[model samples]
Structure formats: C-alpha cells, structure tokens
Target: MTTTVLQNIRPWGAESVDLSIEDGLVTGLAPHRPGSAVPGGTEVLDGGGLLALPGLINSHAHVDKSWWGKPWVSYGGEATTQGRIAHERTERSALGIPSTDSTELVMKEFLRHGTTATRTHVDVDLGVGLDGIASVRAAAERLGGALEVEIVAFPQDGVMRRPGVLELLDRAAQEGATSIGGLDPAGIDRDPVAQLDGLVQIAVDRGVELDIHLHDGNDLGIFQIELLIERTVQAELQGRVNVSHGFALGDVQGARQEELVAALGEAGISWTSVAPPGRGRLPWASMREHGVRLGLGTDGIRDLWSPYGDGDMLRIALGFARVHGLRHDAELAAAVQLTTTDSAPFVHRDQHELAPGSRADVVLLEAENVQDALLRTPRRELVLAGGRVVVEGGELTL
Candidate 1:
C-alpha cells in the first residue's frame, strides 16, 4: 500500500499536525510521534498551511435541476412561471429525456466546488412522478464515491394543493428515493401539523429520512415546527428529521424563538440555513446562542428559491463566516463537523472522525494552521473514503 503522508494538517483545534495516509486513511500522526517513517509507498505532502477540514455536505440541493451554467431566477418572484419552468426541467432530467448539453456541465461544476455529499429534492407532482429524480440518481451513481447523493421525493407544487402528492412521495421512496420531502405546511393552507405527521409516517413506514422545506415565517410556521418537534420526539426519530429553509424562525422574535430552539434541541431535529444573508434579517445567531443543533445547507442550486450556490461547502461555511462574523479557526471547525459527523444523524450514518476505527473518511488540506486553512480555500490534497483515495488535488482516483 502506498502510504500518502500529508506533511502537516490542521484539525479542529486550529493547530497544525502532520498526518499519514495508508490504504486511503490516516495511519500515523506526526503530532503523536515526530519523524514517523513512510509506512509503505509513501509520498510526502506538504500542508502549505491550508485547512484540511472534512468534506462539505449540501444539506439542500436540487441536482436534477442543475445549474449547468444557466441563469437562475431571483427570489420569491419565482413561484409563478419560473416554478413551472423548473418543474418541467425536473421531469426532463428524471426521465433521462436528453437534457441540453449543459446537464453534464452541472454535475462537473458541483464537484469542482468541493461538495462531496448533496441531498437533492426532486419534483414529483401529478403526472410527472419523481421528476429529475432519475437524472440526479444516475449522475450521483456515476460519481460513485467521488460525490455521494441522497435524493428526496419533493412535490414542488404543493402537498394538499397538488394531487397525489403524498402517494407520489411514497412511490418515489419505494422507487429508490433515499428520503421524502415536505414544503410549507401553512403556505398552502394545508394542516401544517397534519402534513408533517403524514410525511413523518411515510418516512417511518418506508424506513427512510424526512427532509422538509419550510416557508412559514410567522406563527403558523412556528406552530408547524413545534408540532414537528413534538412528533419527532414522540416517534424517537432523533437525527432522522430536518427542516430546510425555516427562514420564518428569523421573523419570529423573543421568547418564542428561544422556545423553538430548545424544543428542537431536545428532539434532535435541526433546521438548515438561518436565512440568506442581507435578506432583511436572519435568525442564525439567536438559534446558535440558544444552543440549537443547526447546520448550514445550500437550500437550492438556482431557482426562484435561491439564486446563489455553486455547491461549495467551503462557500457555505464562508457564508456563515461573513454573516455571523465567525473567525477563521471556528469556520474550519464548522466545515469539519458540518460535512462529516454532525450530519451523520440526518444522513443515517454512524459517527465519523479521525479517531480510531472511524469509517476512514478523511480529507487532507494544505494549510499551516486551522485559521489559515479556512481563511483561505485550502486545497483538498486528498479525500479518502473507506481507506481508499477518492480524490487528490488534480487527480481523482476512485
């Protein structure tokens, strides 16, 4: 086995430590013992003071609806004709119905930006069942270990507002969908709690995860979230439930928001992305201050929903950096946990880390210190999964 040694690596502590890779995993630590020998087929790699955090997890993505270097529509103004366009795009991608030449380009861009794992929601409303689901599935499969994807059967139109939304979601799950999706419970005048419960049941019955998109920014939204927490706790579905785009939480001020975080923490259910930066306001700080188990996600690749995302985990982490005034070292730590273990619960994986006997999913970055690594987009010199080098700088070898 050619042991690859990342001469110096920065870990969570914001300190530089030398690490060695054997069979695609950390084998020896220079910090543990200085001047460790090359295990076998060893190639020396210099940290160059870049941060080597864990790969990033795109908590939210619509891979079937790839950017493909296309122009994305702007914010809320998208619910109309643009949504229809996006919906159709999903159907074409899922059926493998010969997308524009740009489709392949989309997936390539995703990898270039360092998003190793992405959970994408596919539209499957009405006659279009699991629209774009197959496209993302195929693409994710092709990427194999380089990039892993989790698909959710999302009813882009509405649950109650659309026909067979629940049944279609169920079908998508049965047809290899990794999880199910939910939209604004109150947005469409549906019983927010009922919709939540129904979706939760579908996830439970299907033995899958639930990734919901929340749009209620008022008491209605908070009520729905509270009900979700209540149901998750009752079902003991810890780490298996998540609410994406709960920007409404940011709008709700005072004790209620504090209560929401507390309840969510106890239930082990988390919300993604406080709110887009400079969009009037955000609740990320308060949510963190309240000790909520929050993680960052690029809610959408390019839609009326969100127009800015390159699937870069570093960028997402950096977004948190600028919006919340996070220091560099802290950003490094955020990137580490955000991708690897912190998201294990939502993704249904066992704990992972550099510690003994973890799954050996490690990334080697070139940075002298943790702060430098995060402050700068350190090169992912090596990305190893299951003790095999999957990606290294310019070379990608699965």
Candidate 2:
C-alpha cells in the first residue's frame, strides 16, 4: 500500500488542488497550499498546471476483429451492412491475424491515448465460438490491472439466421461474459420479435446485460427498437440493456422522433453511437433529459470492415463533435461527457468523475479545460489507473 501526492493540478481545469492516491484509490483531494506535510518522503508528482480528468471510457468497441498492426486489407464487395458482415467473416479466417495479437496491439494503443476502461464486443458464433472472448480476455490480463475490459458476447450474425448462435451466446455468458449482444433483429434476422425475445430470455436467465446492435435505418430500425423496448419491459431489464446505433432516430421527424426518444427514456435504455458519417443519432440533450444515457466508441479500428481509428477516444470525440456540428464550448463539453461519465456504466463501473473517493483511474492532459482537451485531443501527460501511473509523457510505462 503506497501513497503518492499529485501536486498543482486543475481538476476539469478548475482551481488548483492536490490529489492523494493510496492503495489504488483516491484517498484525499485538497487545495494546494504551502508546507504540505510529507511524512517519510512521500512521492509527489508535479502536475505542472495540467488538467486532470476521469479516464476515458469506450462504451462500444470490437477488440476481437481489429486489424491494427496488420497488413492493410480493403473491404471488398457490396457496401451494404449485411454484405460487409459476410465479407468480414470470410476474410477474418483467411487473414489469420491472431485475435490475441490484434487485441493486444489495439489495447496498447488505447492505453497510450489515455483510455483506461472499455466495453469491447467480442464476436461469438459457431465458427469462432468463444475464441474472441478468450483472446481479448488474455490481452486484458496481460495488460495488468491498468485497463478494465467488460466483454459482451456479440452474435454478429443474426441469432436465427445462424444456427446454434443463441446456444453460443449462452455458453459465452456461462464462460464469464458480462453481457450478451444481438445484431439487427429486424434487418438481419427478419424476425424482430424472435430475435429480441431470445436475447432477452438469455439475458434474464443468465443474469447478464444486453447490448443490441441496430443498424437498420428508417422505419425498419424504429420497428426493431420498439420490439426491443417491449421485450425489455417484459423482462424488467430496463437499466441493464443498451441499444447501439439506433439510427432510425435520424430518419423520423418532429412528433415521431419525440415519441420514440421519450419511450426510450421511459424504459431507461442506454444508447451508444460510433458517430458514423451520414447517420442521425440520438440528440444529446433530449436523451439526457429523458434519462437515457448515451456513450461513444470507436466501432472498428482499421478492421476488415473499415480502415479507421487509432484507439484515441479524445480523437473520436473531436470527430463526433465535428460530425454532429457541436461547435460551441458548451456543446463540445457535452460531447466530452459521452466519452467519460455516460460511457462508464457500460464497463460496469459507477460514473467516473474527477473527485475524492472516485476510482483512481484518471488522465492528466496538456490542456486548460475539457472543451480545449476535446478540441485539441491534447497529448496525455500522465495516466493513472488504480492510482498507479501506467502512462506518462504520452507513453505507456507498463
């Protein structure tokens, strides 16, 4: 049990203060003053006026399928969602990039960029089984305790379309997966009721969370979410469910959009967006007002699906603001919220804010304030996970 004092830092770039860490927990925080007692020569880190923030949380990611540190392979064939899914499955086996290698490389990059916690969706199907989960889990363990990874056993292919997928999802849950995922129920499975019902049943029986990917836009997408809400109510899993990429909200207008967003809030369902280009996601204020939490993620990182992402959640926040036209300081501040507190729940942790008694996972950035940090995607000066400095001077220490 070691105690270190971080002196001369601005929390959220506010008043200068000293943060005390002990045994991987934030023990004390107080305004910096002269003649601070240091018994037995305590280690004190100089913040140098750096802005301290809660560690970034990636609410949604595909760690298993990332192609980072691999040869660039362009996605071939049709550009449709289903087409890309098929191509991804075919090329994944042919390319033979070991999941451990890819996941480790991506996790390292994420750590380098100041993300200390994440929720990664590992692909689970008949062909891959639980291999993806195992690989990512291994990478997380090897990274030591600095990074916390919450695994979702994702059925990328439709539950009904792929025989034995539901069984595999259950097996993944039994094998320690924290959550079960579903693909486009209406678009992929063509049976919204069956897909939603099956996922809910598994989630209820296994006592795990649910993360459903709904890419179907327009009326079809809205229909799928409605079915999901119905099932969620029936199972009484409102707060335990997340609807990722509910793009249909972008298609509807006025009263209809209001109606759907209100329903989502009423059910207490969470939403995550990768900030895809040309897609309409939930309005940040409306969702927050309705009590529906929102989080951000880098869906795929230079994967077979697309060539993108460098594992920087700050960079993702910049792009998200740009895509959504979040220009004002307040707006950008709101966008930053998506990457931190709002996303924390997906990782099975309470909302992480820079405060005394909070988890000691935090980042010190070379910026004046959070809005500036988001806009600049400033280099990380220091990163502490569990009160231990794992990254310093924009590099990983362990």
List the global CA lDDT of all models. 0.63, 0.85
| Candidate 2 residue lDDT tens string, 285-321 | 7788898888899888988778878899988888789
| Total backbone collisions for each predicted model | 6, 0
> How accurate locally is residue 216 in candidate 1, as Cα lDDT from 0 to 100?
68
User: Model 2: which ten-residue window has the lowest total lDDT?
Assistant: 276-285
Give the worst 10-residue stretch by lDDT in candidate 1.
95-104
Listed in order, each prediction's TM-score against the native is 0.80, 0.97
* Candidate 1 global lDDT: 0.63
lDDT of 1 by residue, 261-374 (tens): 777777777766633675324555555565565666665555434456665666666566666566656555664465556665444446555654444555666656545555
Off by over 4 Å in 1: 1-5, 12-28, 32-36, 39-50, 69-107, 279-291, 303-307, 327-341, 364-368, 378-398
Residue 392 alpha-carbon offset, candidate 2, angstroms: 1.5
